[model samples]
Target: MQPCDLTSTGGATIASRFYEPPGRPRAAVVIGGAMGVKQDYYAAFAQWLAAQGYLVASFDYRGMGDSRHGPLRELRADLFDWAADFDTVIAATLLRGGGAPLYLIGHSLGAQLPGLLTHRDRVAGMVSVAAGSGYWRDNAPQLKRMVLYFWHVLVPVATKLFGYFPGRRLRKVGDLPVGVVLQWRKWCLNPRYHVGAEGTPVREKFEGARFPLVALSITDDELMTERGTHVLVDCYANAPRRVERIAPADVHARRIGHFGFFREQFQTSLWQRTVLLLQGFQPSQETAA
Candidate 1:
C-alpha cells in the first residue's frame, strides 16, 4: 500500500492509498467509501482486490479522515464538492489502470454520488453495496423513529451551535462538515431524495449515467431497506442496472447490515462475488438500457 494525494476541484488535496497487484493487472478498481467513514475502513477490501489482480485506489473525501487538513467548522464543501472528489479519484485510478478496465466499488454514499461525476464514463462498470436513498422516512421501521429524531431535533441544533456536526462525540455517525451534514439532511427529507432534492440538473445527470451497474442490498440493512435501495438505483434510469437483494442466509452469515459487507469475515463469500462482478461477469438481473 502506498500513500498518495490527488488534487480535487478548488485545488484541495485528497488523501489516498494505492494497492498494486503482483504482476500484470487484470483491472483497476476505485473503492468509494460511505459518508463519515474513513478510507482506512476500506483498506482490507482494497488489499483483497489487489490480491485478486486488481490495482485498487481508495481515499477519504475532503473534510474527512487524512484529507481534513483544517478546522471542520471552516471547511466549505457541499454535495457537489464530494462529487468532484470522486472525479479526482476516478482520474487517478484510470491513470493507474494503464489501459485496463476500470471499475468502481461504491459503498452507500460512495455509490450514490458517482452519477454526479462528469468523469464517470471512465469507469466500465460499478458495484454498489448497500446503496440507498437516505430519506429518513424510508428508513427501516426499527430505525425510522431514531432517524427522524436525529434529523429533526439534533441535526439543526448541533450544526448551528458547532458549525459542524460532532458526530464522533455523539456516537451517532462520523463527524461531518456542516455543509455536508446540512445538504444531506435536506436530501433525506425530500421524497425523491437525491433527485428532487438536488434539482433538475443533477437529476438529468443521474439519468445520463449509461454504464453497467450491479446494485447489491442486504436484507438486514436497517438503514437502507429494499425500497430505499431501489429509490437510489432507479435514479440511474438509463443504466443497464441489476438489483440483487441478498439475505444473511445467502452467505451463511448471521447478519450483513449496511456496513457489514465490508467486514473482513465476508472475504470469501461476499467479497469474492464482488470480485467476479468487477471482472465483468454479468448476471441475468440487468435491465435493458
Candidate 2:
C-alpha cells in the first residue's frame, strides 16, 4: 500500500493508501470506512483485495487518523465534509486505474453517506457492510440501553464543554468535531434517520443513485438492528439492492460482531463471498456457510 494525500473538493486534506496488483487490475475498488475508524485499519483488507486483481484505495475521513492535522476542537468539519472526501478518493482511484469500473465497499457511516456522493452513476457496484440507519429507536437492545444517556446528556454536554467530542478520552466514538457530532445526533434521534432529519432534498439525492448493491448484515451486530438495516437500504430506493443476513454459526464462528467481517480470519469464508458478489455471480446456495 502506497501512502498518498488527496484534497477533498471542500479543500480538506484526506490521507489515503493505494493498493495495486502486479498485473492488470480487474477493476478499481474504494473502501469507505466506518465513523471513527482510520484508513490504516483497513490495510490488510485492501492489500488482499489488490492480490485478487482489484486495485484498491482506502482513506481516512477528516479528523481521523493521518488525515487529522490539528486539534479536533479547532476543526470545523461536518459529516458532509467526510462525504466530499469519499468522492475525492473515488475520483483518484478511477484516475489511478485509468477509468476502470469502480466498486465501492462502505462500512457503517461509510455506507450510509454514499448517496451524498456527486458521481454516483460512475460506480459499477457497491458492497454495504454493517450499514444501517442510526435512529436510536431502531437500534439493537444492547446499544439501546445507553441511547438515552448518550444522546440526551453525553453528546450535548461533551461537545459544548470542549468545542468537540472527547470520545477518545471517554473511550466512546473517538474524538469528533462539534459540527459532526451535533448533526449525527440529530439523525440518530430522528425516527427517519438522515432523510427525515435532513429533509427531501437529501432523500432525492439518494434516490437518484442507481447501482447494483449488496448489503451484508450480521445478526450479532450489537449496534445495528434488523429494522435499522431495512431503513438504511430503503434510502437507496432506485438501486437494485440485495440484503444478506448471516448468523455467526452459519459461518462456523462463535461471534462475527459489527467489525469482524473484515478480519483476516474470515478471508476465505466471508471475503470470497464479497468477491463473487462484486463479480456479479448468483450464488447457488445464496448464503450457505
Candidate 3:
C-alpha cells in the first residue's frame, strides 16, 4: 500500500491509498466505501484485489477519516461534494491505470452515489455490495422502527445539539457534517430515497449512467430490505443491472450481515466471488439495454 492523496474539486485534499499488483495489471479497480467508513476499512479488500493482478485505489471522502479537517461542525459538505470526491479518485485511478479497464466496487452509500459523478462514463462496470435505498419505510423488518427513531428523534436532536452529528461518539454511523446528516435524513424518510427527495434533477443524473451494474444484496443485512435494494438500483434506469440476492447459508455462514461482507474471513468465498464478477459478469436479459 502506498499513500497517494488526491486533489479534489475546488482543490481540497482527499486522503487515499494505492495498491500495486505484483505483475503488470490487466485492469484497475476503485473500492468506494460505505458512508462514514474510512478508506482504511477497505485496505484488506484493496490489497486482495491488487494481488489478483489489478491496481486498486481507496480513499476517504473529504470531512471524514484521514481527509477530515479541524472540527466537524466547521466542515461544509453535502452529497455533491462527496460525489466529486469519488470522481477525483476515479480520475486519478484512470491516469494510474495506463489504459487498463477500470471497474468500481461500491459498498452501501458508495454504490448509491456513483450516478452523481460526471466521470462515471469512464467506468467499465460496477459491483454494488449491500447496496440499498435507506428509506425507513423499506428498511429490514428488524431495523425499520429503529431507523424511524433515528430519523424522527436522533438526527434532528443530535445535529442541532452539536451543530453536527456526533456519530463517532455515539458509535452509530460515524461522525458526519450537519449538511450530510440532514440531507441523508431527508433521503431516508422519502419513499424513493434521494431520487424522490431531490426530484427530477437527481433522477436525470442517475439516468445518465450508461455502464453495467451487478448489485449484491445479502439476505441477512440488518439495514437493507430486498425492496429497498431494488428501489435504489432502479434509480439508475439507464444502466444495465443484475440484482442478486444471496443468503448466508449459501456461503456457509451463520450470519453475513450488512458489514460482514468485508470481514476478510470470507476472502476465499465472498471475495473470490467478487473477483469473478469483476472479470466475467454479464447483465441478465431482463435488465440488459
Candidate 4:
C-alpha cells in the first residue's frame, strides 16, 4: 500500500492510500460512508481488491479523517466540497503514470458522487453499494420524517439565533464543520435536491455513458430498503446493470449494520460476492474461491 496527497480544484488537500498488486493493474476507486466515519473501516476491503490485482484508492473527504479542515471561521460539511474532492482524486489518478482501466465503487453517499460526474469517460464500470436513490423513501415512519423536517427548519433557525444549531452534538466533538452540517441539513430535508441515479430522470449528458454497473444491497440493510435499491437500479437505463441481494443469514452478525459489509469477515464473503458480480460470475463457493 502507498499513500498520497491530492488537492482538489478548489485547493482543498485530501489524504489517500493506494494499494496495488505486483502485476498489471486493474484500478478502482472506492467511495462510501459519511464524513464522520473513519477511513480505516474500509482498509480490509481495499486490501482485498488489491489482492485481486486491482489498484485501489480510498480517501477521506476534506474536513474529515487526516485531510485538511475548512478555514477555522467558515467550517461546515459541504457536499459540493466533497464532490469536488472526489473529482480531484479521479483526475490525479488518471493523470499520474498508470494504464489500468478505471472502475468506480461508492457506498451510500459515495455512490451518488460518481453518478454526478457526467464527464467520466474513462470509467470502465461502476458499483453502487447501498446507495440511496431518494432520501424521502429511505427515512421511513412518517413521524420520523416530520421530526427530521422540523429539525432541519429549527436547527438553522437556532443556529442563526444562538450562533449554533441547537442539539448539534457531534459524534466526534470538533470533528465537524458548521458549514458542512448546515449544507447536509438542507440537502437531507429537500427531497428534490438529493435525487441519485436510482430515481432521478437521467440528464442528456449521462445518456452516452455505457459502462457496466453493479448495485449491491443486503436484505436487512437498515438504511436502504429493497425498494430503494430497485429505484437505484432503474435509473441506469443505458448501462448493463445487475443487482445482488445478500441473504439474511449471510449478512447477519453482531454490529454488522450497513457499514459492516466492508469489514474483514464480510470482505471474504460479501465483498467477494460483489467482485464476482462485477466479474460476471455466479457468487458461490466454487466461483468465489
Give TM per candidate: 0.95, 0.96, 0.95, 0.78
lDDT per residue (tens digit) for residues 91-177 in model 2: 998898775678899989989999999978888889989889999989989899999899899999999899999999999989989
What is the Cα-based TM-score of model 3? 0.95
Q: What stretches of model 1 exceed 4 Å from their correct place? A: 281-289
Give me the displacement of residue 214 in model 2, in angstroms.
0.9
Clashes of each: 0, 0, 0, 9
Error of 4 at 175 (Å): 4.7
Report the Cα lDDT for candidate 2. Answer: 0.88
Candidate 4 lDDT tens digits, 6-116: 877567778887776656654555454444565676888888887886667788888677784644335444666777777777776665417556677777767655555
Q: How would you encode candidate 1's per-residue C-alpha lDDT over 1-289 as one tens digit per residue?
A: 9999999999989999999998766877889999999999999888988888888999999999999988899999988899899899889888877777778899999998989988877778899999888888788888896888899889999999999999998998889989999899999999889898979998999988887899998999978888988889899989988889899999999999989998899999999999878666433322121
Residue 261's lDDT in candidate 4: 74
* Model 4 CA lDDT for position 13: 77
RMSD in angstroms between candidate 2 and the native structure over all alpha carbons: 3.6
lDDT of 3 by residue, 1-289 (tens): 8898899987778998989998777787888899889988888888888888888999999999999989989888887889899999999998988877788999999899998988888888899999899988888888875877888888899998998999988889999999888999999889989999999999999999987899999999998878888998899899999899989998899999999898888899899999888777432311110
Candidate 2 lands at a TM-score of 0.96
In candidate 2, stretches whose alpha carbon ends up further than 4 angstroms from where it belongs are 281-289
User: CA shift at 227, candidate 2, in angstroms?
Assistant: 1.1
Weakest 10 consecutive residues, lDDT, candidate 4? Answer: 280-289
lDDT of 3: 0.88
- The worst-scoring run of ten residues by lDDT in candidate 2 lies at 280-289
